[model samples]
Target chain A: METTTMIGQLPEVTYAGVIIKAIIILAVISAVAGFGTYVERKVLAFMQRRLGPMHVGPFGLLQIAADGIKLFTKEDIVPQHANRFIFMVAPVITAATAFIALAGVPVFPDFVIPQEVPLLGGIFVPSIASDVNVGILIVIGMMAAGLYGPLLAGMAQANKWGIIGAARTAIQFLSYEVVTGLSILAPIMIVGSLSFVEFNNYQGEHEVWLVFYQPVAFVLFLIAGFAETNRTPFDLLEHEAEIISGYATEYSGMRWGMFFIGEYANMITISVIASMVFLGGYNDLWIFPAALMIVLKIAFFFFLMLWVRASWPHIRPDQLMWLCWKVLMPIGVINMLITGIAVMLVLE
Target chain B: MENFLAQITTIEGFAFYLFSALTIVLFWITVMSKNVLYAMTALASGMVLISGFFFILGADFLGVVQLIVYVGAVMALYSFAMMFFDATRNIKENNTNSAIVFVLGGLSALALVLIFAAPIHNESIQALYPMHEGVGNAQDVGIILFTKYLIPFEVAAVMLLVAMIAGIILAGKKMDNSLTESMDEDVEDEIMKRKDLK
Candidate 1:
């Protein structure tokens, strides 16, 4: 039932390789998240028929660096009435959980370090940091735990707007989590494996993406992903027009930047998961290299997020809940049931 | 770098100690913190640390489920409900009888720990089946849960469903009472008009 023959053919796993991969993932993903903000600005600007961030370097390429510097140098302010300890810890939780969720995600294909390297020679790096068998479940769990950051931050700040924002954050996150889990259940049932690598391998072998098999699940997952990341339309938690900056109203400087980093990191994580589960993952398509193909897919999802944000207006809080419980969740459950029956019938 | 990697390669007693220490500290904070919100946050962190323990034990399925159910869903709901109350008020533990009860509770807990420790020290427990070589973390758990523990699992699921329905009914009852209270004021006004005519 379980085949390790394929994994056995791969390079050996080593502690050095795992550590190196972790560092690489952290640094590269962080940089990409910064770059994502720039891309978002550019995309939104193009959509709006205006130039965006032209001052910093060529076509505002260095704007992220400038923003980083500004955020670092800006004054860190704690509101007079706020719970200082929890307030300070809140953003860190958001940022940490977001990155931790990436631990289960396979950002790129595995590679072996050359023996020619001086200190760390002949080490094999797996695509994911920790390739736990329950990879998708752990990732989803970590992401869900991230809700505490905004929820606690908003309430601790002692601002009326912050409380309102926190309330919305709690409801929005909890409601959509159901949709995300149920939507992904069908694909998990189809593959009979929760590990992303297995899902990728299944698709690679069958030459058919799970999305082609379960299109409804794919759409539901995508919509739920948007809500989970608190992207536009579903981003009522921090909608500037409604609740000022929402949970981040009182946050300043690097603290505020942490929230943005967490958001972008989560966006990347969702894209990676979607591509791995629904798209062909790191599997080669046509003449494209597997590694490059996955990156391209992730990039497309990220761009789609920014494009949707620019094009659509934010939904009301009630509407967001209505959509989650009444619309998406029911469809997701039905999809899962159908997929389960189909799988059983095929097996029989 | 090689030394660092080598150090991490072995899961030493130090890692266990570290996680245990973290769990204890967070649990203490959860119990002792005056602010309810802080206590709740500490509780959530403690739950995550307990999940860490489960992960160390190679129960990946249980650990992830612990995070999802306890730390993620339950704690989020707790904090959401907590927001409706005033956090500024420091809950005063002024009851003398409560202090006596606390001491008794502490003694009982100590006694219970000692009782459990003796058996653990004496007994050498072995797994019914070796868990190291398995199909997958989730699959292994699913197999046992659906086969050996099927009845218990079904009972738990049914219990959860009943609890969910009860919660909804309770909330509905509150809403109905509020609506009736508003209508009652109008009914009282009509009765007063009749009394004036009499």
Candidate 2:
């Protein structure tokens, strides 16, 4: 798994190196992101005090595989009246956008799985394929890109309800994206660099995790995270009764699976990001190993999201907007200011 | 010998060919697909291909931004709209002006190719700098935005605020009530004048 350290020097292969690195990254993230669906369901089942996927191999570990097969084997139906192009490609966009965003993130130090392998562990390498300096901006940009899938899917269906749902999702995404950007200001200010590595290094020196210093920001982040992911309380994108699965209503079989996988994969990405910024990231916690700490933190946040799903009913679409704009927006801005001030005071 | 292979990177050319085809085919599919939804999806793939081109051009941030903003925001916006309207009617005209749109789109693509062709002549420079570091890097971008581009950035924020207000109003629905409330006082004044006439 940690084969990265085995390679030495910057990955200065031929002109082809860039293409190879990108392809590999895309493949790996897609697999992991696809697997994230398995994790979500298993966790949700456990929280509900029910046996999850006992029927599927070994506590439902193969559940996602089973689901994939089912989707692939199923019919790939396109509505007769539907525009063939957008409908088919919408899922591809949704899935690709979700996974591409993962490329900017470093899953662990020296070993974002593909970037660098820590030489000490015989697994670290310094080369991270390519680092987009504006990793955060890229990520935010992708968030917006990923939204297109749902909108296109719903609209392509040509159903009135589908169109309404798509419209709702777009509006929902626009409102939440602001808070998402604003919440990140704290971490950005502290690091003074948009490079993910610098941000990670800032955390390394602090050792105290941004969550401790900026609890408000953390809370705001979670709120924004919920909206950003379009999850419970903010999942008006697919609020069944009102608009059905929103954009996903018209989609069935494998076409639907792209969106299904993309959503959970993004959840994992967001959870990992939450851990990276607010938790110590991959840093060691107490006596545990760095990997273990990261796992625990990610699990805690991921479960928390599911837990909220179970505990809280979804909010109405209108309330969701109000929360992002009137409430979360102000809080995000204030948090940005407070974090900026704190960083200034400390650095000064 | 190695250098020649390195130039096309067999892998590089192959992936580029594959993705480019995927993009074109998908772009056609997006427009021609009777399901408007399929068209949006195809459009997303087309944009993803555009990002691939950005990648090939060595514009890392631009590529990523293409993925993030276009796929994430713009495509997402496109998808949401598709959802709003049944996109099953593929044969009919969707855009305000199809002829102009095609002409402009073609022109832009041609312009881009011409602009980039000049830079490709310097092979060594191209090899060294896949992406223009100063332009795309966040740190550099931040300084420029905060300094020379600060006003624009602020203005953009102001504009976004206006957009947000508009979104709330439109999405919130029941605009008639607000409209009535705003016009109520004026209506009352007219009513009083009418009463005098009576």
Error of 1 at A330 (Å): 1.2
Task: Compare the candidates by TM-score and give the number of the best one.
Answer: 1
Model 2, position A218: C-alpha lDDT score: 79
lDDT (Cα atoms) of all candidates against the true structure: 0.88, 0.71
Candidate 2 chain B weakest ten by summed lDDT: B126-135
lDDT of 2 by residue, A1-348 (tens): 011222245333332443445566667666766676676677777888877677778877887788888888998888776666667887886787777667666654443234343432222233344455666766667766777777677666666666777788788877777778788877777766666656666787777887887687778878888887888978888888787677777788888888876786677778877887788777766789887887788779878887898788889776886788789899888888877777779888
**Which pairs clash in the backbone of model 1?**
none
Q: What lDDT tens digits, residue by residue, belong to model 1 across residues A267-327?
A: 9999999999999888889999987899899999999999899999999886897799889
TM-score of chain B of each: 0.76, 0.56
In model 1, the runs with Cα more than 4 Å from the true position are A1-6, B1-10, B172-198
RMSD of each: 4.7, 7.4
